[model samples]
Target: MEVEADEEAALLSRPRARHIKKRALKNKALSVSFDEKDLKDFVGGFHKRKKKRRKEAELLVQEAQRRKRIEARKKRKLERESVYGGAVPATDSGSDECGEDDEQDEGSELVTSISGTATYDNGDMKVTVTTSEISREEDKFPSEKMQAAGTQINWRS
Candidate 1:
């Protein structure tokens, strides 16, 4: 019985040893063939090139940020100049025709026209200027009640 148990143990240990040896041989076979000098040179060159690329990327980002800041400053300057009608001395000559004030006035006029406070008569014979108050009163209440009270009341007083 002792000999039989030793034989079984030997059988199991033999396969494990063979498997380890095969794995070691496979790894050895797959090893890359590079001289020490060549390996070091390649690694050093790769790192140097990587560092240069990273520095270039950082410079590009900084340049973009600078340009963005300059553009924003120019926009703010133009806004200030246009608001003050170029009266401020710090205004740039190139920004004189920005028309920011005209745009604002045009926007206000559009709003007024939409609300019926302003009228546009394009050489037509019949020109009607519908007041906002009248339109609002008519919308809020019936025409008869608005005409009677000169105003509109939605709720009973």
Candidate 2:
């Protein structure tokens, strides 16, 4: 029909929006570029790159924590200095002593000295050790105590 032809002509005559979109896409496509080395690295070194990034982030976090701790210690030292010259002597000095924290962690690095014997039997070293009854109790002496761990007895004394 002539009306349908007129409608088709009107539709075709209108400046198309798809042409603008296509022109924009063509401009962007012309500008886009990819480096071969970078593309290969990204495609092949996924795990290694990820691990390196993680390590770098971890080191950054550790450094931040260390700096924070050092600052806190310095602040505490300044406060102590302002308090009193006659204050109780600290276990350690305020200056960076081996860059360590002041808190006493006895578990990590404390050594102890002991005098004589660490254990005293008090003349009653009664050790009743039954290791699977290696031999029947009847076969062993009644007054004897088993010294399987090489516990020295005063036989020569």
Candidate 3:
């Protein structure tokens, strides 16, 4: 117990250790007073960088939302197309007599066989569709004849 006490006394009585003296000297050097202008000069650039990063983050979030909306629109379009049987006319060669008859006939046969039945909602509701049931006037507004006559003018608001 005496030996431990003497060791403790010796440590306390000694001059400050190297690390302690360095820390004390640094603290004393930094004790000088500074005004608002000095503080502003030191912190000005930090605020500008913070503002730039905040704007960039907001733009990224907006882009993500726009992408999600576009994807949803595309998915809905595909589903609607599937629900309507888009096949019978293609199989019947009498529909459109374009110059390339042979190639079109082969392609039409494949498409007609594949799209024979139109199913919706994972086959929960199944409906047999035929091209004759679909009305051409309902599908296309302002018929080709009207467009050729220049009845509708193109206007940009």
Query: What lDDT is reached at residue 106 by model 1?
Result: 25
Clashing residue pairs for model 2: none
- Compared with the true structure, what per-residue lDDT tens digits does model 2 show for residues 1-157? 9999999999999988755577676677446688999998888798888889999999999999888877866766555444433252356454456666445422233223333333334454633332332223433564454444345433221
Give the 10-residue window scoring lowest on summed lDDT in candidate 2.
126-135
lDDT digits (tens) for residues 13-97 of candidate 3: 9878554577676677546787999899779979888999999999999899767655654554344345454433333444223
lDDT of 1: 0.57
Span of 10 residues, lowest total lDDT, candidate 3: 104-113
lDDT of 1 by residue, 1-157 (tens): 9999999998887856433577676677555776999989988999999999999999999999767656655666666556544555443454325633333332322122233434445654434444433343244467675586544222221
Which candidate would rank higher by TM-score, 1 or 3?
A: 1
- Ranking under lDDT, best-scoring first? 2, 1, 3
RMSD of each: 18.4, 19.2, 20.8
Alpha carbon lDDT at 121, candidate 2: 42
